[model samples]
Target: MNSESAILFTQCLQNDFTSLLDKYDPLPNSLHIGYAEANRLLGEMVEDGPVFSLMDWAYEKDPKQLKLIHIRDWHDPKSKSQEDHLLQFGEHCLMDTKGAEFVFQSWIEENPNRAEIVNASGLNDFVDTNLESILKPYKGKSIRVGITGVWTEAKVTFLCYDLKTRYPEFEIAVCSALTASSSLSMHFIALDQLKQILGVNVFSSIGAFTEFLTGDQPNLKKRISTNARIASDKLNLDPKYPITDLDKQILLYLFRDCKEVECKTLDGGFSGNVVLKTKSIDHLGHLQVPCVVKIGNRDLIAKERTSFERIQEVLGNNAPSIVDFCELGDRGAIKYRYAAMLDGNVKTFQKLYGTMLDGSGLDRVIDTVFGEQLGRLFEAASTEKLNLLEYYDFQHKYAKSVRNRVETILGSPQNESTIEIFPGHIVQNPCLFYETDLLDLKEYNAISHNTSYVHGDLNGANIIIDAQDNVWMIDFFHTHRGHIIRDLLKLENDILYIFCKIETESEWNDAIVLTDFLHNQEDLGIPLSFDPPREITNEKLKKAYRVHRKTQIVLS
Candidate 1:
């Protein structure tokens, strides 16, 4: 075996230990906490478990990398010593019974098999056992001892502490996913406590075993990411998106034909999904096909796949196409073509056209985008739908309609708003323009007579400009059979709030005035005047007007 190797210690994976999953009172002397959480850990503990997967990965794939030691929670049945084991957790894991046997059928009953077996009782696992003599050979070699199994607060914790102290040099890695506790909270708390001890590494997912085995740098930097995801649905835990090792396993499966593949988080992240740019390299070290991968909430990414477009020349124009879609446990993953620019620069409209007139913003390129690309998008919206009233309710009719659609965090509209925005700055509420009585059934169809499959959130960040200055849209979670007018309005707002970035009251006033002027121009069905009208001349605001004019032509 290699000197730099590893060993895995799986504890309490026995019939008797199954009592921890009892729904009611559980075992009379069991450290059972709650059934639901226990069962969640159980789902991955036994049949096709992550731990078992690691065991197979090390042995079946490359036994030279690892060895296994199964620790059975066995207690002597004949002993009337009246110790704490009999008093607290009474008569559990009794010797010569099914309770004390290994749950996995492959584990040898006696010693000297592929995997070594150890029998320890209650809290006395570290006391006077053959465990020390068994460790005689692999003692000095720098090896990683992987810890897994039940009652994280008790046996797992105690065993890890003993290993850390006795074999201080050995890397003590505890697979958080493989272990359980009397209570779910204790399981997490124990992990945190164990981290304080030196030479101990608590891996949140067993997928991280690869990092330990190869001494690879940690992929998901924030160890508490999984916990944070579970703790809150809305917490922006990390500024950057993270992918687990299991996610990599799935990606490897997808890109198996490629010699090697690499992934990096893309620029846009407001969609609550990690957009990764994946590039493949062949044996020659030359770049091959590139794609975009998105990992996010299962429901969201899965829903995104429903409208996920594939490579097709719909109307003689191409868009980023979906490559594949899959579920990573509770998260969903989908990959698409990586749209690159002529100069090989992969930039969003936001990065490419800052304020649509700033340093990075090239009017010549943007003009081609406006004259050609965006027009193609709007033209594709030929499919008509007669649901203007439904849009009306969403737009202005409902009590919570306007605020719910406009005032939001990160431009993501929430369902409610308690505070008014930009009071006395410009127009107080946008709903002022969408008055209830002003909306008429006769005008509903007249206002928006056309429809198509529109991007629900057509922000500049989601719009990708490619090599030929063509547009490739991404982050289509909200894509639906909808109207082009909605997309036009959304694009208009993206330029207004996202790009303009109005700093002062005067800039805000200029933006408001310019917006009103653009609206009038859009209604007029003509090109905007050569200059900013209505005394609107904030250099930045004028550029906004120019971009708005191009949109006006598209709308016409």
Candidate 2:
């Protein structure tokens, strides 16, 4: 060959043939040696020829060598495309006279009886016809079955029916790209029935069917068992129905037993429904019982609707020792067996202490009565102090955030000139505390001085010392931070009113001694002067007093 053609051939041998041989395993013995010799010969030929005359000389020597030239040109990356790769190679192989003759000779030597050696180089031009030729062999017996988009019940049913009607002989297998939404179990069930109807079988993958048709079941039972175990494990861990009925029932019972009870009904009597009456049996025993029964929907509302058994377990002898509680019916109605205290016989410290009265002796007496029990309750509550602090912080942050959100709703940049006010604005405004100056009142000052832990609402009804001198401090729900003098002020206020009406020297002396004792107590933080006009009136006083007593205790 000429130098140019020889150079091209030598390059092909170096780049393509070297890599091509590595790709194939157990290279043909004769062919491998022949190719290696051809490569060496081509390299020598290129060195001897003049580059200008090499192409013409090569074409004259062997026209069959044109394939090497064409392959070199076609492989250039810049000219390569699907069209160029197939059409160019195909058309050149079929039309090239010398190349076709060489291929025909090789074919004849291999199979002498074969008359037809079709040149499929024109296959690119007649894609449809070429496809027809390949499929023509199987056309009459080939099956045409429908495939489903989603493996739902309806889709699977339709696919089965269509398969049976259209391709009854060949077995049909539904194909699915297993997904969370696809039901493989349902698909398999439908396919199994279709298999029987068509007298064929079902399979998931091509390998499975090929093995099945060849009578080689690839341990499908093992696969099915493994898959079934995985599915069952997944279903077991699902939280859709995690809790049992008994669990829910117990939770509901506990919630009802723990929630605070509020009075919903009142008896038509002088004593209000929410009031409690205290009776003392000398210094030995004291009993405080609800004055009026509060019931709703046939259920009695007490501090809690705890069972008599639970009450006995907790309080032992302290829980209204003489009284008997009976369940009235199957539906939770209850009745208490006890006598109501006589109005005159029961002495509420409120009557003796007076409104805004100071009674240090009474404070000592009441503290003596419930001090130990209160201390225990406080200790028990302290265990959850971290939780309490977290809740307090959350509440404080929430209040500030909500206030900002409400302000945004009430006034925006667009409506700044025409802002409208609502009735709730006065009460809910964040600036109310700063503007009112109520916290600076002298009454608050006296209250703050007299008690660091004041009986926040030291009203008459809250205190009751029976004939036996056993003190009972009731209605502690409104307890708050203030001076012990405030409790004394409240007590003195009540005693003064009684004194003004009856002129009792004993009551006056009691009030004076109590007030002085509260003032002298260094730890009590009592104020020097009694701040009169304590903002609370007889009409609104009860509500105000209740609010003051329930002062939320915030610990820093």
Candidate 3:
């Protein structure tokens, strides 16, 4: 309706047409001849024929102009043939007419308006002179050329070859005097002969519509993509991916949703899921925005679907908007509003910052961008409340697993020396022990505080920042009511991971100290910050060191 929307619609139409046209324009395959070589070969065949004379007639009663060719064999109609003589004559005719009729018929069929060959004719003039000049008038236009007389497969092949190569824009057809039945017989025999003598499968040639004769022929029934057959055992499917009907229906459904939208298939490789992007408009036309269509296996996504439904009920506009959700047999598709302004995430920011925190004027930038934003986030979480009993239940369920994970990493005697894991030790045993220790500390266990709504996966990649610097969280596949500190720690480790990736052990330590200082800043809103080494003891450094070392190992 609007200019931008109209433009997008037009572009979509263009793309759809472009894609469809590709189906008709097949590349030259094994069955097709090289255009130039075909023309030359056809010319040679015609030139080697028994000499023929051409007669031109301008009709007096009609506007028709016709040319008739009298071949040496055709000129001997009056001769009565003995048995052996008749066979010899027939054989000679077949040889001479081999490729002639094919070329003539093709030309006549293709060039109805501009060119015509009324009867068998000698190729002496046409071949000796520039053939290009003879058909020059029909060069840029579609013309119909009429051809008559019986021809062998060899002649038909030659004729078809010449017409296709020399006058591509012309349509060739048999004369009306030649009935459709007669033409069909001629064509059938022509193809048979061509195959037998020339090894050319006319039906398999490029641009030929012979799909109906092949196993790969497309299914023409109307249906959804579910009917398609999966090609291999590796692909998750019912029977297998089909060649025709299902593919068309999918495109049709997509077109119906967003009139001029183009789909980019982003299948979850080996996951048996199909993801696509389309201009967002549902069957009911509620919203006209870009959206993602995720079609997943019903068996795999039942829990995920429940999670999405729950999130929609609880978060409202704080999360991505769901458009249409439907189940098509065993699989389902969910259309959700897509964000066009999503710039990048936390990982993006850290990678961009690089070692800039070590550079001048950047420390102030870091304080403003990260320190202030994180401070606000923590402050926001503190104001939210969670049920006390539910909080304890979550802590109890994960406490033992956390303890085991910590013990496994730190239990090894070889992990005692810091030098053994100095660089990226954060992901190693020492880091795990530190996290587990923090969980077990009396200060953490003694407090009965409200657990708030927290992003379950709070990594930098999950946090999307827009052009205006506003942050948004995505991928709530893991959303749950969890501890506020869990989100905070995840964000901290993400930031630390970046440093470990680019900085040495000393640089990593300096970054860890800076992060600690920012969290401890006055009014920064964190419930608690890293204590000084004298207070928490130098043992805390081992955790930070382990975090860096683990990060290094994973990256390597």
Candidate 4:
């Protein structure tokens, strides 16, 4: 942290971070001030300054802390090797603290810190050879790369392009302090790489990208890579996918009781669901069992874990039992498990009904499986005693937000004409505008005489129907206590409004059946039901529905 170095850091930010500053508007002044403060502190510190470590003090402050740009891990000088390699990444970081520990043979294997700390260049042949075994665990996954010290431009280039090209399935997340003028050269490309890992194509170049990345849209960046699409596409647990030393060890731990375990990639999407079937020695003899493993974002897995505890508290034996749970590392991985894979999920049923919605079997299956389970869930949740009155107030606020979004759309000249034509089209073909009106209906007041804990995002996709017609809820990403309106509306709207907008035949028929169920939902056993006054169904509500529907189509 010398004066020359301090001046260099400030200059680099002024240049490379220009687009980010302009895009955020507020950052130009705040960041300059932050950097000035940071430069002042550099006089008393060395390589890693506490003042600079806060990240917000100097570089662009990311309010959500959405991106983990770099990481560092060092060995004590007194260790057996007596030599320090910069924070060695891959296996060392994954295993030294968590995952599983490695056992060494003899002094011949004394080289624990074998891989050199990668700098701003290519991986050496030794690193190329050893990195395979280390990264094998993350073959079709994302990982956090560690930089021993500060990250330079060349290092960023090698990481973003080279590492990405070499390991296409593996996404990279790193945390590091920016250093040297090197980063100034490729900051734009680095932004692309960052957004790519986040599974977004928002920035075609440095200019367009910074607009949103530095704006007041913290939630969007936080949610960028957390979607099911990325989760579904990346993981490849197929046995044919290849395994290395560490992969075998992981398998052994996962199937501790099993011998001759064979894993195969299932049709599960995102959220990393794979089936592991194996033979185990029991009291009688060898027996076969099937278990499902889920590896995904730590937050989502953490949510499911919490849901498991709540289910056990309220609906014991009604849900799948959790087999295991573990956090891989900071900005790395999270694993989840269920004792066995069930018959099928609601998504499977929806797909099936997509072609066979007219069939009585599909209708009966939905009623028998979903109806019964939902009844029990609501019954159990009813005992929780939530404040429904306050929940309605929150719903009104949400409705207002939706209205604001609609007004924004209406204010845009490009959308004004489209809004004008919609009402006329609605009158000519009410069926065509049926879903639109439903969306427009903002009368979300009134509480069902019954109140209970509502699954915050209960869509057909989240519900799983098993062989015994038992229902298991997955992806409890949004779970809260309130009126059951959220769950019921989400299910109905997803099946009818959302799916019907894109799908055809049985899918539409399925929507129709679901719509009928909603209109006649008296016996649905949901704790909360609502009735709204005419005044509540404002013009903004309708416009918002239209705008939201259009946005969904475009984004999807």
- Report the lDDT tens digits of candidate 4 across residue range 1-556: 1111010011112221212122234433221223322222221222222223223222343313222222122223344432333223312222133211111112113433322221111223113234344344445544323221122233334444545676675433322212221222233344345556543232211111122233221122222233212222222345554433333333443343343444553234444432232233322345544454544443455455444433343444444544433232211111233344443332344454344433334444445333544445565445334445454443333444554565565564222223442323311222223324445553446434544555677655565554455445555546555564456566546554654453444433343333343465464444322322233233322222332233222212
**Whole-model alpha-carbon lDDT for candidate 3:** 0.36
- Model 2 agreement with the true structure over 461-500: per-residue lDDT tens digits: 6555554554444433234433223454464455444333
Q: What's the TM for model 1?
A: 0.47
* True-structure RMSD, every candidate: 19.1, 36.7, 28.5, 20.3
Q: Write the per-residue lDDT of candidate 3 for residues 44-73, one digit (tens) a residue.
A: 223211010000111111223232221222
- Show where candidate 1 strays beyond 4 Å: 1-241, 268-271, 283-286, 310-317, 338-344, 355-385, 392-448, 466-471, 519-524
What ranking of all candidate models by TM-score puts the best one first? 1, 4, 3, 2
Candidate 2, superposed: residue stretches over 4 Å from native: 1-303, 307-319, 326-344, 355-357, 379-382, 386-463, 473-556
Give the candidate number with the greatest TM-score.
Answer: 1
Residue 277, candidate 3: alpha-carbon lDDT: 44
